[model samples]
Target chain A: MAETTAPAMAPARPALDETLLAALAAAAGDESGGLTRRLAAQVRYEAAETPSRVRHLWRFTDPARLLPMNLTAVTGAPGDVSHTLAPSVAGAAATIDLWPGLPPVVALSDDLPAGQLTVVSAGETAGSPALAADELFAALNEAAWNTGIGLAVADGARLPGPIHVRVHASAAASLPRLRLVVGRNAEAMLVEQHLDGGPETRVTGHTAITVGDGSRVRHAIVQVWGQGTNGHLSVSTKAGADADVLTVFGVFGGDEAKLEVRTDLAGKGSRSEIVGVTLVTGKQHGDVHTTHRHLAEHTSSRIDFKAVAAEHARSTYTGLIRIEDQAHHCEAYQENRNLLLSDRARADAIPELEIHNQEVSCSHGATIAPVDPEQLFYLASRGLEHGEAVSLVVGGFLENTMAKLPDDVRTMAEAFVGPRLAAIREGSA
Target chain B: MSDALLNPANPANVFACRNLHVFVKDGDQEKEIVRGVDLTVQRGQKHALMGPNGSGKSTLAAALMGHPSYRVEGEIWLNGERVDALEPHERARRGMFLSFQYPVAVPGVTVANFLRASLAARRGTEIPVRAFRQELNEAFATMGIDPSFITRYLNDGFSGGEKKKLEILQMLLLKPAFSLLDETDSGLDIDALKVVSDGINQASGPDNGLLLVTHYQRILNHVQPDVVHVFMSGRLVRTGGMELVTALEERGYDWLTDEAAVAEGSRT
Candidate 1:
């Protein structure tokens, strides 16, 4: 496939201030006219024409840069801001930002880069319709994304600790997109946490990650938006030969949340594992969808998801494991388990297998269950009160699934899921 | 009923069941399981209730322990207090213990924790861990049971003999004022039976009264009941001293019919 870049385009609204574009150009460190042109062609120019509720709201403003970092150049225009985010082996100034909002909002500066790892943190205030879309684009375009953390470590190069990026929204409405890139023969762990300020906040974000040959990356996203907050995440990963990728998506607190993760094993001898756990209650809805494409020979992938629903809550899971013709000798496995703690709770599981290669092995299974009365009575008879008995049994039930995780992964899983399950049990009681 | 036996001022008797009649629901009707029977165990006395299978000896013990399934039509007094209306745990709180013939297993809860919880429920205070452990270790040593058993799930994965020994261990820790040993020797070998009987004898004090429920004389030979009562047709037809246990052992329950007939004839 050829490396493609979009064309440059004029502004949709002539009156939209060119000063914002000038600031964005300055933030795009390269200052190359071709790069700026490439950034403009990919944007939805007419999106700025959406009807506005308030003129003071400034819904149709052009994409602007509020702050600039010197580490990487951004060639793209306001429409699609593209810059490189590379780890500073010698400790460089690593921060980036877009235009500040009309109203004062909590803004977090990008983190200082550590050995072979870089971090970016930001908060955006979004509003009705067009502002929401604009805020999403602004956050994505403002990242120091030049050459995008490009590095090709030698085979068997071990990257130490996780590269942590925190996307925080302190407004009633915000959309933040955090992106990351990894290199060949290098290993990296990335943790992203989505925290909200209020119930009315709405977030839509996308993270694009790529792994190089003989490298491994473990990525995790923990979403805890308050009541009425809607959280959406779209993640994409590409693995090379002998590369391993693991992703844990935990959804605990949200009015309604949908997490979609897609992984592509583009080379042979690669493995990708997707694991997720969700706890929802009080009319809450949780949706976890994963797509695994085995595009190379001798690649393998596995997906496991567990959810607990209570008090009229609903959970839906849709997963796909596909092995293409070129991916012969591939193995894929998928499983989903749901525990319903109340009669009104509901769970829906969808597992699909699409195999074009006859030499591949693939399997999928799902299960939904209510609390076992016999187990409850057994615990109660042993002098644990009814509540404690149920708690212990529930803990045991979830622990069985956790036993399959590695040490660090298991600790992360427990820290993310344990308190939420406990809270649900307490709320039901 | 004589006034002397019924008087609350009488301090000699620890438990008195007067004409106690128990019934069980058979299909849609309440069928009598324990006919009219008067039994008394004096303070510090250890007596045995021996009978054939289906003779309602266990029903009497259940009635004394306030089993919800057993409905009594008579009065039961424990230590001068009427206990016919109490619940099982309430009766247990009042220093009553019943060692089940078949104990239920509970997984994930250690035996020591269960014992401490039950003891706390009875004593209404937090027991010091050091004191509790000391007493538990002592009880285990006396009963010849391994100390590791206390750390396991209550009765879970335990053998029949181990379950029986655990029951005795619980009895020792709780120190009930009165205990009903229901076929404690049913599944035990001779050595286990001896160890269990010895544990019971060591735990039983001057203030604790016991009623042993069994079908055989094997346990009685080791425990040495102060009195023996033979139950038949849901009623006790004969009550006697140690000699009576020997008689029942020598001739079996066949002589009980002749002995009952002669007693009735002489009374007439």
Candidate 2:
């Protein structure tokens, strides 16, 4: 299948002035052979039109709301954030600090495998394809990103411990990028966490991963921004023959957040599992979209996304599964369940499937409902108060998705979710 | 009636309800399901309220437990406290328990976690982890349940017998002062029946009272009832000893219904 690129024919729009581009270029310290790619990305961002509100991808969330407003880039100091590192295996791991309007500070561990893992200013890494520069946000991230980490795992290298990356954005507007490539028969786990931002902060992040034949990868992205921040993040993956990819998303914060994840199965016997848990409370709004495209035979994919909204908060989920004409004997299933905690809280779910092959099996289901009254009654009959019953039911609603997270990350997510549920109960009371 | 029987505060009685009327909304009309039931269960007594289908036995039991779907009128006293105005959980905390006819499934809640939370609420303190686990293991063994069921979701995909067993397990763990088992014998095979009957027998003691609301007399063969009452048309018409169960099993409830109808005709 031909690589689908963002449409080149876009309406003319006012581009960022040359002075801002110069400022970005100077801040990026473009001596690392990334100037040309950044320039091309800028051109694409300038040419691309804002997504139309009628487009299905942008229907639930207004694109204009995500556009970074009257905010200028500010240099971030290392003291502004704190980080911890605990790598499971004796492999090299790097930490890249991304503060807008400043060159990234890259620190590598003592045991660095030369050329296997490198931190670059921009462009592709480890023979991985460059950022698609297609969508408006992708192009913007590629053009303005201040930090990038590229990791390439050699064939047969199995890393039992996960490579954890944590980014805390203190700048008014922040952009961070990552590129990963897993070789044949390799096994790797990556956890990327976006944590801690000011009330007025805005974040835009992009990550691309390429899985070689017979590889297995587990990737989790957890975002816990401030209650008044805005976050937009996109992650895309392409899996080769017999490659298995499991992706988990935990969206717990941000006043208004939009997340998009896409997976392309380009080889036979490849499979993907996408799981997401989003908790919104106290007037927050969250929108998530996912797509799984099958381009090879005997490929399969499943998506399970759950959301809980409380206290006038709202959450939306849109998922799509597409099987190409030649992709035979493929199986795809998608399920979305939303639990509303208050009459004022709301949720929306949209699931779609496009199967071109007659031999494929595809199914999708979506439900948006308040906590089941019968379930509440049953729990109450067991001596649980109404508030306790609500919390238990809400916690159970997200348990399946939370179970997919690693132990430490699951603990962190529970700590974040527990209070939100309690707040909801208190608000209702 | 003796003054002691009318006084709900009598020490000998573990549970009592007076002039209890349960009404449920059916569209725009208020339909009475349990009409003015007055009964008292003494300590150490097992009472069986047998009735035909649609006799409002389940409604009466639910109303007694303070289910919110029904509007209950009258007095419900448990362990010397008037509990008619309390919520279901409040009533439960005051030593009232009801085993539902059709227990709802709570997905993703493991039986162990649910049981722990319930015990915590009942005891007003978190049970020690090791002690709770030991007690749970003992209960599982007594109920003949596989230990793996502790990790399974609470009644999510459980079969009929499993659900009933879980209800009984909860009763034994919580050790309520008064238990209302509404049709707990329905949808059980002979083997499940004996197991459930044994669980019921184990949960009953001299300190507590049991009200077994069932439509069949088969379970009576295992757990003997000191008092048997015939419920028909939203009220109990006859209260007697073991002879009532023996007579109903042979002649069915039609004869009792006819007698109750004649009595109602005379009253009107």
Task: List lDDT for all candidates, in order.
Answer: 0.65, 0.81
Evaluate residue A374 in candidate 1 and report its C-alpha lDDT on the 0 to 100 scale. Answer: 51
Write down the TM-score for model 2.
0.93
For the second chain, the TM-scores of the candidates in order are: 0.93, 0.98
Best by lDDT: 2
When summed lDDT is taken over every stretch of 10 residues in candidate 2 chain B, the lowest stretch is: B1-10
Best of the candidates, TM-score? 2
The most accurate candidate by DockQ is: 2
Retained native contacts per candidate, as fractions?
0.02, 0.66
Worst 10 residues of 2 chain A by lDDT: A83-92
> Distance (Å) between predicted and true CA of A18, model 1?
13
What TM-score, computed on C-alpha atoms, does each candidate reach? 0.57, 0.93
lDDT of 1 by residue, B1-268 (tens): 3668566436667787878899998999999998888887777889898887888887788777776566889878778787778766666777778887877665545777777866775676769999989988998998898999888877778999999998888788778777889999999999999999998998787888899999888898888899888988788888887788878778888778777667668868
* Candidate 2 segments whose C-alpha is farther than 4 A from its true place: A1-15, A29-33, A80-97, A105-116, A125-134, A422-429
TM-score, A chain, model 1: 0.69
Q: Model 1 residue A2 lDDT?
A: 29
The positional error of residue B173 in candidate 1, measured at the CA in angstroms, is 6.8
